[model samples]
Target: MKTKFTAILLLQLLLISCSGTISTLKKEYSFNTSSSLKSNWNFNPKEWALEKDTLTGTGGPMHWGVIESRKQLPENYEINFRVNMTKESLFEVMLNLDKEKYIRTYLYQINQNIVIGDGVYDKKDDSYGKRGGKSLFTKPMELQNNKWYSVKIRVQNNQLYFSVDNKITLECSLEKSNLSQKGKLGFITNGETKITDLTIKTL
Candidate 1:
């Protein structure tokens, strides 16, 4: 009887260990209400608005806008969101941002080219200074305005992966970059765009 009891205890301990290994870092945002947005994000009220479960950003020429999350992200994680560009312009996802450095994954609507790069942040001006970027595709991909597209980004062990509609995938190495390992997530736009269904999970 002692032997059987010991075996059962061992099994229970093993099960507990396995369960503890599972990740517990899933977060979802539907953008269905203003309370959550007001509490969790930083953005300019004049440039961004929430309507019908969508967060819309309206930027004019020389007037870019950014909506940054209040929570700092984990070092290794995945992020997903849906975006619709109301007009052809620059849309970028900023990651691992500190006061002095950041990583930018951006798509140019005019050419449909996806690019990733390292950026210098100017804290005094609250603006980006200089950046060096690389295009993911040799040829320009086809993209259209006024349509929703699903975007996914994964960061793991100083590696970054980006995808659009699960059709085009790009990877980059952040080992030598100056960006922080864990930092805030943000969206930057230079024209009108709408976003919804943002989610993030740790690896």
Candidate 2:
């Protein structure tokens, strides 16, 4: 009798957990405008320490982030945005899980408006590591300071593709990344940066 009761209780708990996750995903959410930023998106403008507000095609945000726990997204998702930055500023975007413990990062920066390229980071070593993808590009991407570039990231299964303006730039794969599955999405910058039309679509 005791074993039977335990089994029944476990079944009930499992059903409840699955139902909760399904409900969370059913709701449609977006963050492009100020209204969306305040309602669904979670970010603190003060945390980034605002310098000034810049413009884009649509609503632009200085910085944005959402907690891993609050997000119930699919395993595969695409993050695309138009990023603009100054020569003195740096641009870094990442998908972080376990809060500040672990992060898989993709960075684009312009220093003195001279060199521009793609960078991957592993939080475990506190270092910038090599990128993972299928193919490699010969020339590094040239980014203009105070200008916007269309960036797209597609994470299908274990493969990741980074492209600029629908052009294939660098392709890499992350086999041992802690963020193997979907979690939190974060955009961070130290100097000055602007992001607009940020969209997260999942398959």
Best by lDDT: 1
Model 2, range 1-203, lDDT digits (tens) per residue? 99999999999756534331112234444443445344554555443322222222211233222212245445676766677765334455555343343233334343222212233433333322322221122335566568877878767776666667775355445454334354555554554566665556675
Q: Which stretches of candidate 1 lie over 4 Å from their true place?
A: 1-31, 121-139, 177-179
lDDT values for all models: 0.70, 0.47
Candidate 2 at residue 27, lDDT? 41
Instruction: Give the number of colliding residue pairs in candidate 2.
Output: 5
Note the residue pairs that clash in candidate 2: 132-172, 132-173, 133-171, 133-172, 133-173
lDDT of 1 by residue, 1-203 (tens): 99999999999756533331212244333244677677777888888888765788876555567777777778788877788888757788888877656787877777777767775545235433443234433225677788888999999988888888898877877776444566787777778888876667678
What value does the lDDT take at residue 159 in candidate 2?
61
- The per-residue C-alpha lDDT of model 2 at residue 18 equals 35
TM-score for each of the candidates: 0.76, 0.56
Candidate 1: worst 10 consecutive residues by lDDT?
20-29
